[model samples]
Target: MKFVQPIRDKRKIEAMKKVLKSESVRDYALFVLGINSGLRISDLLALSVDDVTTETGNIKERITLKENKTGKTKDFPIGTSAHKALKEYLDTSSLETTSPLFLSRKGTKAIRREQAYRILNNAARTVGIKDKIGTHTLRKTFAYHAYKSGYDLSMIQKLLNHSAPSVTLRYIGITQEEMDDVYLTLNL
Candidate 1:
């Protein structure tokens, strides 16, 4: 499997977001929720409307689920951007409580992982992102920005369900030069 990198350029991130949003609210919400929640594509694709919605059809502030790969439960708060996009999508889409959150064009079931990859790749290409973007890019982007924002490394490791901090470090694509810069800058 070819390695995919996180979107480190803020401009490209914003551009991709814009492209997805302009394309469809469903697409926008999918990307926003993925990057914000750090969920694997399988987990995200498996979500039903009830998973993120209340009985009254309001978006939940936090969502919880058992991960498909790890069999461990994880809960995360939806970020503002993701929340807004989700609300917009919910309002416009003819989705029921049990319907797949990200349905395919036929609306019979959740989209396949391959289709999700195509959507992400097309959006990335539209925004002129030259990186090797793929479904994992969303998860890596979440961890990369979280660590860059000074979020706890242990917390990120747990979120990604990695066995160690070192694995999380490498998963987020941290470079030795960047680590060295952090050491030099933290002169306290």
Candidate 2:
């Protein structure tokens, strides 16, 4: 599948939150976990309470999974934001350690890519970003924000379980324009 990059903006995130927070607490948890974990939506959708929140009350060790696409084991430490989101969702729903991390309004399975895209799009429309947003957007948001926060490209690559730094940079949307600007502006 050709991954379409989504524009990550503060407004766009807020719009998604407005929609997600307006619905079930489970949905809000799903959105927060994705943006924070940098997990593929599939991994996020597959999460169970035991994958994150635990009886000890702090998050468990890093999430470990074999990514469906790459078939490689990936592990990422849960960030503060994701931890808080999961806790809130757990508290609200009283989910057990083994229950699915997210669920439908009727408490069925959470959702798949098709339904996830629709849920996010409805939120995007309300927030007024006409740009395309997809299930991958949240995952990309995690990478974009991590890049902006100064995480090394190589480290980000490792976190995403990507094979190369170049691919990671491109996925995070750094471009020749920015590179050229940097080259031209360098005083040293």
Candidate 3:
């Protein structure tokens, strides 16, 4: 298996959002929620309309689910960006409460992992991102941006459920140059 890098540039992320949004609202929601929640592709794809919305159809404040990979229950607050994207998608689609949030074109099930990968990869390419992107790029992008925004590494480690700081750093594609800059810039 090949390693994939995070979408490291903010402008590129926006460009990707634009491209995906223009293509399909469901695809846009998938990308937005993926990056915002950092959920694995499996877990994200497994979500249903009820998972993210109330019976009255309002977006929920938090999402709680058991991760497929870790088998651990995760509960996270929905961020404004994700919530907005989801609301937009739900408004446009005729999804029932039990319908898959990221439904397939046939409306029978959620889009497959491969399809999710294609959606993200094509959008990345459209945005001129040359990085090796896959479904995991959403998770890595969330972590990379969180770190860049001054979130503690330990907090990020916990969010990702990683066993160690080193693992989190490596998984998020933190480079030696970034580490060196920490030392160089902290000349206090």
Q: Give each model a TM-score.
A: 0.95, 0.86, 0.98
Misplaced by over 4 Å in model 1 are 183-188
Tens digits of per-residue lDDT for model 1, 1-188: 57999998878888988898888888889999999999999999999999999899999999999999989998888889889989999999998899899988885799898888899999999988888989999999999999999999999998898999999999999999998998899999
Reference-based TM-score, model 3: 0.98
Best by lDDT: 3
lDDT of 3 by residue, 1-188 (tens): 57999999999999999999999999999999999999999999999999999988899999999999999999999999999999999999999899898999975899999999999999999989998999999999999999989999999999999999999999999999989998999989
C-alpha-based local distance difference test score of model 3 = 0.95
